[model samples]
Target chain A: MKAPAIDKKVLYAYLEEIKDPEIPVLSIIDLGIVRDVVMNEEGELDVTITATYTGCPAMDMIAAAIRVEMHTLGFKKVNIRYAISPAWTTEWMSKEGKRKLKEYGIAAPDKRFSIPADGVECPRCNSVNTRLISEFGSTACKALYQCNDCMEPFDYFKCH
Target chain B: MSESLINYTLHLADNALILGQRNSEWCGHGPVLEQDIAITNISLDLIGQARSLYQYAAEKMNAAAGKEHPAVTEDTLAYYRTEREFKNCLLTEQPRGDWAQTVLRQFFFSTYQYYLYQQLQQYADTNLAAIAEKSLKEVSYHLRWSSEWVIRLGDGTDESNRRMKEAVNELWRYTGELFVPAPYEKELGIDPGSMQADWMKKVSAVFEEATLQVPEKIFMQTGGKTGVHSEHLGYILTELQYVQRTYPGCEW
Candidate 1:
């Protein structure tokens, strides 16, 4: 018996259920890593994803998650493609996603031109006394910053 | 006309590829979840560098050969080549001595790569410049991570400091391979001599900050660029090339 066909809209909804294992607050779709989804003429499903960082360890797990999700949803012919060019940038992050990141205590990347090289405003306290501790944070994509006002160490999503 | 450009590219690629493979071996064995993720992240970055370099090499070879799709893609060139044909420097191919050693090797290599890529960004070749520009950002983080670990290990305790010092000493001999100019590199427009001085300065600063003594200069090990390599490379190739060698032309 042939497997049931899945629509792109339904596929997206299915994908929305897959949360980034590290940051459960953000869904893969919400993270903006899911670039595009297409159903080929032959009925095969193709999903394209761009990694937040080239060295992101999550890509493999993410791919497996997509495959497993689609399989359970009854799509047997699914292909995942990695798009490396034009590279993944923090700029692709959605507004809602940024809100979720901030809510989760991770400072979202600020407007690129607004912040000077010396420092960025504290996301928690809105204080300008924040200091740059390190360019790398807990993860490859985030920068470590300590807010003098809040006395909190937070991960700032580095603007690519 | 300079083979050094190609040799340098290959050396950089080899370091990334081999070290990446070693790090990937830690996939299921990391001491903790965060550390696992971090090591794997480094592996991914190195593999990405390997892919970029291999692709560039393939492109150059294709142009030279006048072939539509060069006979070998990066993956093939990466996995299928024999030990002697591999061009990674000796330092990267060494056994991961321990957590201390592994971190030290990473710190040393990343610091060196950071300086090299920063200089390469101003290379005469635009493509090389572009690749260097992209890699510099990644290597910068790598250097940061490594440097942090160096300080942690060196300043932590008696045992930690001793282990950190040992790691540095063991890996010191291979450090010279990073700066020595291959003949091809000298002929090509790429000159790494000045860059070597810059790299030493950066490395010394980091070492000083970590309160670790920088090893004095010693005789350097060579030969990866000339296709001669250490014994370790053979075993590395066996694992890396297994899939490609088993099923020639196989693709996902």
Candidate 2:
């Protein structure tokens, strides 16, 4: 029997529903982990992803999730590939992803080239006067921070 | 799948794993929160690289031997290997004594890694080149971070200055072994010795800015490349391998 022809649009719709295991507020699509999805001549659906950090433990979960989503969508010939070149950067994060992060209480990364030593606005009060509690947060991709004004501690999505 | 290639990959994996394990000791014990997290991030990057290298090594070994040989995995390579089987440099296997020592050691190693990976990005082997390309960016940040700490601690205050000097003196001996490449390493990868001149220039510039002196002349340590490490590695492996050894194929 011939493999059912799966439309690229349907595959993308399914992918957009798979949320990041670490940050449930955003899907892999919003986080820019999904670099591209294409149906090749052989009809294999190839999904390319870039990791937020080299050691971001969520990578395994992300890959597994992608596989599960594709299988659910009736895609049998799905291959997940990693793109390490142009290494994943905070710049790839979508505008909607940044908004969701704030709503979820993790401070979005500031738009700066270097690791920002200061001016990490607190997710709680939107206070720009925040202090770095720790350079590392509960996860490798986040930094610990506290608001000087609100005194609320939160995670900052660290820029790579 | 060549033995030399497998060995070369193992060599890289071991260095990253050992050093990453060492740096992880500072997870929550750092003097301050920011630096603590920074060091751990460095640890994560190293271990991540080690995982990819080990996976590559295992896959290559499995392909070469077929079903006649037992399975080889990243865990087995890391947790089951004996002291003599590990091929990391002595600098990486050394103890993470103080914050200054940790920072200084990272500075030396990261500088070498930056140049090493830069060359690796252009290797004839595409897989190796890809790994290098990804890792080089992370190592670049590590080099800068450690370099700043060296300068800050060296020039900062009286006590910090004294400690930084002590760290510099103690770690300097191990620097020599990093440049000496094993025969297999040369065959499978670029000769590490070729990167020494560039490594020195970067190191010297950082040391100069740190207002610290590199010893005018010194004796270099060897043997880590040959799997002969200091007593420190034994203890390191004990902690590192404890879980996998105890559980036998334990998973997170």
Q: C-alpha displacement of A97 in model 1, angstroms?
A: 4.8
Candidate 2, residue B123: Cα displacement in angstroms equals 1.2
The alpha-carbon lDDT assigned to residue B88 of candidate 1 equals 80
lDDT (10s digit) by residue, model 1, range B1-252: 634556666766787899999878777677665566667778888888887788777666666666556475787779777787677878888887678888899988888888888887877877667667777777767787788888888888899999999998888888887777777676775565666777778778877877889887777787766677878888888888988899988987
lDDT of 2 by residue, B1-252 (tens): 389888888998899999999999998998887788789899999999998889889989999989999999988999999999999999999999899999999999999999999998988877778888888867877887899899999988999999999998999999998899887887765689999999999988988888898886789989988889899999999999999889998677
Clashing pairs in 1: B2-B188, B3-B184, B4-B184, B4-B185
Summarize candidate 1's per-residue lDDT along A1-160 as a digit string, tens digits: 4445657787788888888877788899888889889876666789998777656778879999999988887666789987655456667777888899888888788875223243576778877788876554577677667888889987787776
TM-score of each: 0.72, 0.88
CAPRI quality of model 2: acceptable
lDDT of each: 0.77, 0.87
